[model samples]
Target: MTTKTSQGRFFEDYRLGETIAHAIPRTLSGGERALYHALYPSRFALTSSDEFARACGLPAAPLDGLIAFHTVFGKSVPDISLNAVANLGYGEGHFRRSVHPGDTLRAESEVIGLRQNSNGKSGVVWVRTSGRNQRDEVVLDYVRWVMVRKGDFDAPAPPPHIPTLAATVKAADLRVPKGLDFSAYDFGQAGEPYRWGDYAVGEMIDHVDGVTIEEAEHMMATRLWQNTARVHFDATLRPDGKRLIYGGHVISIARALSFNGLANVQLIVGLNAGAHANPCFAGDTVTAWSEVLDKAETAVPGVGALRLRLVARKGGAPFRLRGEDGTYLPEVLLDLDYWALVPN
Candidate 1:
């Protein structure tokens, strides 16, 4: 079996209410857990320390919800974002259930709307993607929009039109999965030395550290997600016999990397944009870079807001995410924009 060349589609190819079932299945495991913890000192009260989880009424320590979201969203990259120019926004996201370690994840996408650009060169596509487990239960859901290049157009005359999205999910709109409760939360081991007030606008720092991924790790991650796309797992699936690492793995890795500098960031508030600029395979070591984008005040007094651009690349370079040609190198895997709850 071989991975499809799926060049993906442009704005012209999508219609309202059209669904796109992605072709990949992924699985999460202990390694993912270790990576998650190492990448961000994320104790989260529920994700780390099985002992704490049991006290919290969980059967065991659960995988972080954000990790699950990253895995589920990563599955859509090949089918939805391969040709995207910009990821406009994400909203209406709900974590409907808790995900534990060793659970398998799968994803599917539905096109909700599309609008063509008058320039005939680009357009935007809106999609709602849902993630399910091996048991076929809904675990995550969200709406995202992307700017895609136009594939073809016979005649173009209408002026370009674009859509807008909500800045944040309202409190009433937050669906914090059935089993999550802060009532039993443990505050000691989460590993942050500061709260909201420690942060100020215009701060930047490097999330110091590197992670080296292997074939087995990437394959296991892809399979766990039920991301059936062969290239991610099957060495024999490629003519070169090289198994491709899942793009989302790199995203998760990079996000975790941000924990080093953005240590006080408590919650992922917004996903402004993201990109898997290049393909990453096993055997490449990853390093991270980050830049503060913006900041704001939040409802949680001890927590302020920080928006950042996090990047992941192969090896220890000058942290230049792009190559000489301005294209992402095969070593570069992620260009992500997100908002987090951090120290003020």
Candidate 2:
């Protein structure tokens, strides 16, 4: 038998400025939409009803922003983070277009930075990835860094090159879907009465809901995205003998929880920053909260953008993100900052 299988690339294999076109383009459908809603407690009106979407000027109900994000992120996992210890952080992520069913999506990433850890066992690889639709239109762009294992301890460290990433995507640069007209947005249909002017900076909202993780659910969701990361699937990969949940899984659930108070906040346009504070395992009950970080008006009439800090926790008190020591608390699972479209 001719033996042929891929072992995946290690940290030593990456070179700065190298562009990788990830394999396996995916054509999305209503199946993914149904599975996503089944995996997470999602109930956004624009994505749930075609009438609601058209009322807001969209041709049809679009998939959740995170769905598109996870699909794109999943395409790079086998090549970028198959042996990753953890995905460290995300910055400068922007959703350029809304994806409806029947759209084909592909991903490409460029190695922007590399730094070997002093221990020589691992290194951090920073990459900027772009998700493009079949038309070659870029749907999303973001920067992420992950801690990847080094296959050879004796391999010399690559020259350190850390890319300077922007802290936030500028409001002006945020792409509002063409023909998006919220002037006719219906509050009753959308589920929340609060408009853009209602959210004041520094206000905190406890979503007041919790969902315990199920190993099967996370695995199913990860498979739905076609993510091939070993850490999320192989229980024996971790010393604890438990599979790790995908970080995007937590993000989707957290965003879903936010709908309790932010129901009318539709369309995530920008991801300023995010961090997975701790590893998530099955049976952990996750709750969430949100803070109004900032607000800005958009060129689109009757539309505004809100900068929000969404926090997911296992069992922490509401509104607590970090401890006095300026580090994320042990119970904190995720800290995500992003911009969403809301009625002005």
Candidate 3:
């Protein structure tokens, strides 16, 4: 009998410069938005109400940016990281356009970098993934690298080819949604009165809330995105027998927690860099903090951009990130840097 099952591509199978188009395009609807909001404490006015969005010059409320991101990332998992050890980091991420209900999204990725780990059992693969809509317009573009186990230990190592990525996405390159105007924004409705000018370059904010991770919710979120990474679903894959929480889950949670202090940050347009500093499991109470790294003005009237560092940790005093040796503390779960559009 012939085997029709795919065991998934291992590290030795990836070729630099090869492009893979992921399967099963997803068409999102209000159901996705509803479920996303139910899963996370998301309440940004622009995405929460059509009236609010129209008031800001948009036709209707758009899906949260992370909804598009997770959808795109999930589509690529089977082709890119089905046999992975871990999804390491992301850089140069840009949300090119707003994603709304009724749009069908698909993803394609190009392998740009490859490096074998010294252990010979695993290697890192970097790919630039682009998510496009049914119209073939790019919605999101980003680079992510993952460590994947090798199916065959004796396979010859591929020559390392790491692509140099931008350390930060220049403000000039950010794509503010067309017609996004906060000139007549309702400060009371947004949940916070803080405007872009209110934030200083070095200011820090403790989000002042914590949500204990629940296994059911994490599983639901991963399945909602169609993310089929074994580590996220199969406890037997890890030595500890714990299903690894999806990094994006932590990101969404952190972003939701940020609403307390950053309620007026209406939209996320750029992701400079991100790292899953440590593995997260169910039952860990996640908390977050943010630092105003920098700010910039956009051509869009009434819109400004804020460069922020959002950190999610299991527990510790706020503002503590890296340790004395310049490594993330064990309690730190996520270190994310991104740019958001705010009322100027």
The model with the greatest lDDT is 3
Q: How accurate locally is residue 341 in candidate 2, as Cα lDDT from 0 to 100?
A: 94
lDDT string, candidate 2, 237-340, tens digits:
99899999999999999999999999989999999999999999999999999999999999998999999999999997998888899999999999999999
Candidate 3 structure, TM-score to reference: 0.99
For all candidates in order, the CA lDDT equals 0.67, 0.95, 0.96
Ordering by TM-score = 3, 2, 1
TM for candidate 1 is 0.63
lDDT value, candidate 2, whole model: 0.95
lDDT of 3 by residue, 76-191 (tens): 99999999999999999999999999999999999999999999999999999999999999999999999999999999999999999999999999999989889889999888
Error of 1 at 115 (Å): 8.7
For every candidate in turn, the CA RMSD to the true structure comes to: 6.6, 0.8, 0.6
Error of 2 at 32 (Å): 0.8
Question: Better model by lDDT, 1 or 2?
Answer: 2
Q: What number of clashing residue pairs does each candidate have, in the order they appear?
A: 23, 0, 0
Off by over 4 Å in 1: 1-15, 19-46, 50-62, 74-108, 113-126, 131-140, 143-188, 234-241, 316-319, 322-331
255-338, model 1: which lDDT tens digit per residue?
667666565454564566676676677788878888777766645433456667788888646356776888777666787776
Candidate 2 Cα outliers beyond 4 Å, as residue runs: none
State how far residue 224 of model 1 sits from its true place (Å).
1.4
Q: Each candidate's TM vs. the true structure?
A: 0.63, 0.99, 0.99
